[model samples]
Target: MSAKTIVVGNFKGGVGKTKVAVMASWELAHEMNKKVLLIDMDPQANATTLIARSAGITEIESSIFESFENSDLSKSVLNVKENLDLIPAAVSFKNLPKFLYGKFSDDIDQVSYLKTLLEPLKKNYDYIFIDVPPTISDYSDNAMMAADYVLIILQAQELSLEGAETYISYLQFMIDEYNAYIQVAGVLPVLLRPGGRVDHATVERAKELFGEDNVFENYIKHLERLKAWDITGITYKDHHDNRAHQIFIEVVQEMLDKIEHFEGGEVNGE
Candidate 1:
């Protein structure tokens, strides 16, 4: 099987992007029998902490930020759970702009450094999911550029739409300027207050703007399954409540289907 990387990102915050990233990685690793690498790029380290706790491991503090200035990979990486590994986040990462752009002087293309670092590890995992922060930076750009495809998570709100639009425009710029090889993984809709006024309309607008082919077939309804599973030390797919578990399973399979479509195009014509 071929390796794939999916980036979960949005330009605006507080839209469950991190949650989606964590759940997607967990589902892939625990449910689908796939080896997964979860890269916690956000300084918050929510995904890192969540997975670490689930596995009864220590919450991670140090992360790929250190990898930017340091040569040692061991210091930045942690095996947070069975069949899954993580590169946690650090508070120091918040101040990485000058360090990466100014201090790393002569020859390093810091943008692709993370990619180079992961090249040797690609064969070890079937999927790598990168959780990006709301702000734009080399860290987010590097991950997106390195990825086979990028996934943008959006909520059914005007603010979320603004963020998604900004992100997609930036991604289009990157693809045109530097990463002509990259393809968008897809846009996933996480509807807030599932049946609320304007939410259904918001979903329709999203499909129209992103194109029908780029939207997920399964729209994530507002549900308590996530928080419940997070607090209980169980996975969504492992919950006794089969309804919620099945919805997420359908999402995972839909993502795989979209990715496979891209791959098929490459083999057939590209």
Candidate 2:
């Protein structure tokens, strides 16, 4: 089966991009029992640390920097458990762009070189989930072109809303001008507004601006369990009974159903 490569990205940071990427990868691997590959393209390496212990400052060999520069990345990958593999990250990833900038001076496709390198691994896993940085860097561009579906997570707050608009406009331009095959899954509205409110007014505004059908039907509430992983190294599968973990399981199922829907005209319908 051709696995669906999904990317979790946002132009604005602190919207839980790493959280969703880690949780989704675990859910797909453990709950769905599908082989999952987690690629950390973020220099912060938050997702890598959360998934694998002691990241951010650690010198991980299987990181994107080494692999992107023609290092033996395949050997750096670690088996997280049954059906889950991880390409960890290091602080060195911050310099990947400068390292690769001079390699292909005239090639427009050079930005997507990482994705092309990873394409061969499509046969090695059932699902590939990428955690991209919160900026429009070369890493983000690589993830965008490589992904079969892109999920943009955002909050309803003023700053995040503005970010959504700006991000949509820019990526839309890129889709029109560069990658036409890139498919935007939806804007996942993470209801981080305090007091557990959705601000239906804002939701309606977004739907009016970007299409009602394109908006995700479900929203992840602001839960303490969602942030509990910050101090802990356990991922969703490791803390299977936690509320946030279960929610992640549900969210991954939702994404898988969407993938099935797009591939053929059917959802899991369960």
Candidate 3:
């Protein structure tokens, strides 16, 4: 089977999107032994910085911008691990919207550009993850269009929950108008506290809005160790006893299950 492209996104920032992307890549590469390429589509480049730091890469000589300029994904790909690779994003991607405006024919073709650029690399990896920016822009559009499934991440905050609904509505709109290939992998809740009242309430409300099955049974508890790992360039394998690491392993398992069983948006009349 071809690689399954999953975009980790939410219209709300500070929702731990990068953390989840980084953890998922680690789990897929080291645990599941999957060849994974993580594309950092966020101009903030948190995922890029995290992976680069972990790989001891101090200078970023090439990046995703090169792919946009030359349609050569190879130019930007960094082999960070035995099975993990990354297409690092730069702050320069802030200019992508203006660049895309003049490059593609119309809105439809503009969003479709990423799929064309990454098509040649599809067979090289078992999974590809796109880490998108928080807002609706050419970057997120391209990621969504290029993806087979989107994994929406949100914290159990009021604004985050509201933004999740808005983001899903936007996805539905995209499916109706431009891409019918994408469906939601699941809505993952990152709880600041595992059993906090706010977290419980938010999960229940999310089930009410998106359906219980649409949300994953497992939730990632907020762990301070994760932040330290990000800063220290420590992989979960090295931090073997950390509960956050175990939680991510469960999350990865759930992702694999969902992807395996996903009927496709087109098949489900989405």
State each model's C-alpha RMSD to the native.
3.5, 3.4, 3.6
Writing each residue's lDDT as its tens digit, candidate 2 over 1-270 gives: 556788886787787788888888888887788888999888888888887752223445467777777745576677877888888877898887777676777445666676678777887888889998888878777777788788777676543366677667767766776663567677677766556667677777778877776677777778765666677555435444477667777777666666676667643222
Pairs of residues at least 3 apart in sequence or in different chains that clash in candidate 3: none
Ranked by TM-score, the better of candidates 1 and 3 is: 3
TM-score of 2: 0.88
Clashes of 3: 0
Model with the higher lDDT, candidate 2 or 3: 3
lDDT of each: 0.73, 0.73, 0.82
For candidate 3, the 10 contiguous residues with the lowest summed lDDT are: 261-270
All candidates: TM-score: 0.85, 0.88, 0.91
**Candidate 3 local lDDT, 50-168, one digit each (tens):** 99888888998898987798878888989998899999999888888888888877889888889888999988888899998889888888998999988988676453487688789
On TM-score, the candidate that comes out on top is 3
User: Candidates ranked by lDDT, best first?
Assistant: 3, 2, 1
Error of 3 at 66 (Å): 1.4
| Candidate achieving the largest lDDT | 3
Task: Please provide, for model 1 over 46-148, each residue's C-alpha lDDT reduced to its tens digit, 9 standing for 90 to 100.
Answer: 7777777777876555677787677555567778667778887767777666666775563236566667677766777788888888888876877777787
Candidate 1 wrongly placed segments (more than 4 Å) = 59-62, 72-75, 103-108, 157-160, 194-198, 229-232, 235-242, 265-270
